[model samples]
Target: MSFLNYLRVWLACARYSTVRTMMFRFDFIMWSLVELFWMTVNILLVSVIYRHTREIAGWTQYQMLLLVGTSMIMQRLMMGLFWSNLFELGRNIRTGQFDFFLAQPGNPLFMVSTRKLDLDGLLNVLVAVSVVAYSAHQLGLHPGFGDIVTYILLILCGLIIEYGTLLLIVSLTFWIVGSQGIEGSYFTLFEFSRLPKEAFRGASNVIFVWLLPVVLVSNVPSKSIMHGVDARYVLWLLGVTLLWLLIGTTVFRRGLRRYASASS
Candidate 1:
C-alpha cells in the first residue's frame, strides 16, 4: 500500500485508541498527574545535584538539566507513540491476541506497533519542554533556529533508534515465547540515557555508548544543540540508527515466519 494510505490507517487507530482511553477520565487524569509529578521530581533531583557539583562528565549544571529534560521528553514521546503497543508482544503472542493483528489488512508488525496511543504520556511533553526551556534560561544560552532544527532532527533519529531497539527486544518473544524481560530491560537501560556519556568509564562507557547506545537517544540530542552538532557524531548516530532499524526489521520478519497461527 501507499505511504499515505498506511498513515491513514495509523491515524484511525490512534484516534480510536485516544477515544477509548478518554472513556476512563479519572484514570487518565491520575496518570497524567503522576507523569507530571515524576517529571518535576526529576528536575528537582538534578537541581539538588547541581547545587553540590559544577559539572558531571564535562556537562555543566544547565547542560545536565537539558539532557535530563531531553530524556524526559523522548521517553514520554516514545511511550506515548510506540512503547506500550510494542511491549505487548509477549502477552499478545501468548494469549493469541496477536492473531488478530496478523489478520489485519497491512503489515502485522506495523499494526501491532501503532494500534494504541497513550494520551497521558503525551501530556508530559509540556513539562519536558518547560524543563528544557528553564534550563536554557539558567545557562543564558540563546539557541538559534539552526540549533533548534538540528536538535529536532537528532531527537527524531534518537526516537527511531529507540523504537527499533524495542522492536528487536519484543521480537524475541516469538522465539522465547513468554519472555518479556526485554521490556523491563529497556526501561532499566534508560538510566544511562539520562546521564552524559562522559559520566561512564572503561567498559561501561563502551557498552552503553557503542553496544547498547542509550546515550545516543537523549544526551546526544542535547549535546548536539548545546555544542553545535558535530559531523562525526551525526554520522555515527545515523549509521547506528540505520543498523538498528535493519536489524530490528530483519529479526521481526524472521520471527513472524516462526509464528504458529492460533487457528492452526
Candidate 2:
C-alpha cells in the first residue's frame, strides 16, 4: 500500500482506540496517574541518591534526571504507539489470530503494530519532556537549534531501537510455546537504560553498553544535549538502530512463515 494509505489505516485504528478509551474514562485516568506516579518515583530516587553523593559515574542529579527523562520519552512513545499491539502479538499468534493481519491490505507488521494507541502513554510523554526541560534549566544548559534537532533525532533513534528490541523478542513466539516470560524480561533488560552509562563496568559494560543498545538508546541522546553532539556517538547509535531494525523485521518474517492460521 501507499504511504498515505497506510497512514489512513493507522488513523482509523487510532480513532477507534480513542473512542474506546473515552468509554472507560476512569480506567484511562487511573492508568495515567499510575504512570505519572512511577515517573515521579524515578525522579525522587535520583534526588534522594544525590543527597548522599555528588555524582554517579560523573552524572550529577539533574544530569541523571535528564537521562531518566530521555529514557521515559522513548519508552512512553513506544508504549503509546506499539506496546499494546506487540504485547498481544504473541497471544494472537498462538490463537491463530495472526491470520487477521495476513488478510489485511497493509503490511502485516505495520498493520499489527499500529492497530492500537495508548493515549495514557502518549500523555506521559509530555511529562517526560517537562522533566527534561526542567533538568536542562537546572543545569544551565542552553542547547542551540542544531543541538535541539540532533537531540530529537537521537530520541527518535532510541524509539526505533526500543520498538525493534520488543518486536524481536515477541517474534520468538513462533518457536516458543509462549513469550510471557521473555516479554517481561524485555522490561528488565531495558530498565538499565535509565542508569548512567559509566555506571557499568567489566562484564556489565560488555553486556549492556557494548553488546546491547540499551545504554546507547538513552545515554547517547542525553549526552548530546549535555555535552553537544559528537559524530562518534551519533554514528554508533544510528548504526545500532539500523542493525536492530533489520534483525527485528527479518525475525518477524521468518516467524510468520512458520505461522499456522486458524484455518490451516
Candidate 3:
C-alpha cells in the first residue's frame, strides 16, 4: 500500500480508539489523574532524595526529574502504541490467528502492531514534556534551538530502541514456552531502565549499559540535551537500535516459518 494509505488506516484506528475512550468519560479522567499522580510522586521522590545529597548518579534533582520524565514519556507512548499488539502475538499464535495475520494485505507485523493506540498515553506524555521543561528552567538549562531539536530526535531514537527491545522479547512467543512467565521476567528487568545509569555498578553496569543498553533509553537522551551528545555515542546508540530491530525481525521470521511448518 502507499504510504498515505498506510497512514490513513493507522489514523483511523487511532481515531476509533479516541472515540471509544471518550465514551467512558469517568474512566478516562480517572486514568489520566492516576498517571499524573504517579508523575508527581516521581518528582517528589527525587526531591526527597536530594534533601540529603546534592545528586544521585551524578545528576542533580532537576536532571533526575528530566530523566524520569523522559522515561515516563518514552514508556507511556510505546506501551500506548504497541504494547498490546506486540504482547498479543503469543496468544494469536496459540489460538491460530497467526495465519490470519499473514493473510492480511500489508506487512503482517505492521498490520498487527498499529491496531491499537492508548489515547490516555498522550496525557502522560504531555505531563512528561512539561516536567522536562520545568526542570530545565529550574536548572538554568536554556538549551539552544538546535539542542532542543537534537534532544527530540534523540528521544525518538530512544523510543525506537525501547520498541525494539519489546519486540525482541515478545517475539520469543514463536518458540513455544509459557509466555506469561517470560513476559514477567522480561518486565522485571526492563523496569530498571527507568533509573539513572549511575545506579548500576560493576558487572551490572557493563551488562546493562553496553549489552542490553536500556540505560541509553532515558539516561543518555537526558544527558544529550544537557551535556550534548558526542558523535561516537550517537553512532553507538543508532547501531544498537538497528541491531535489535534486525534481531527481532530475523527471529520472528524464523519462528513464523517453524510455526507454519508445524501447523501444516
Model 2: CA > 4 A from native: 262-264
The numbered model that scores best in lDDT is 2
Candidate 3 local lDDT, 197-248, one digit each (tens)? 8889999898888898688777777888878877777788889878877887
Candidate 3, residue 146: how far the Cα is off, in Å:
1.2
What is the lDDT of every predicted structure here? 0.84, 0.92, 0.79
- How does model 3 score by TM-score? 0.91
Model 1, residue 51: C-alpha shift (Å): 2.6
Tell me, by TM-score, which candidate is best: 2
Choose 2 or 3, whichever is better by TM-score.
2
Model 2 superposed RMSD (Cα): 1.1
**Taking the tens digit of each residue's C-alpha lDDT, what string does model 1 give over 1-264?**
779989999899888988888798999898899888888888888889988988888888888889999998888898788978987876787667888888778877788888888988887887898889998888888899988988888888888888888888888888887585767877788767888888889998789988987987786788777777788888889898899899888999998899895554
Please estimate how well model 1 matches the true structure, expressed as its whole-model Cα lDDT.
Answer: 0.84
TM-score of 2: 0.97
What order do you get sorting by lDDT, best first? 2, 1, 3
Candidate 3 local accuracy as lDDT?
0.79
Model 3 Cα displacement at 236 (Å)? 1.1
Residue-wise C-alpha lDDT for candidate 2, range 1-264, written one tens digit per residue:
899998899889999999999999999999999989989998899999999999999998899999999999998898799888998898888788888789988799998999999999999999999999999999999999999999999999999998999999999998895556678767888899999999999999999998999999999999999998889989999999999999999999999998876555
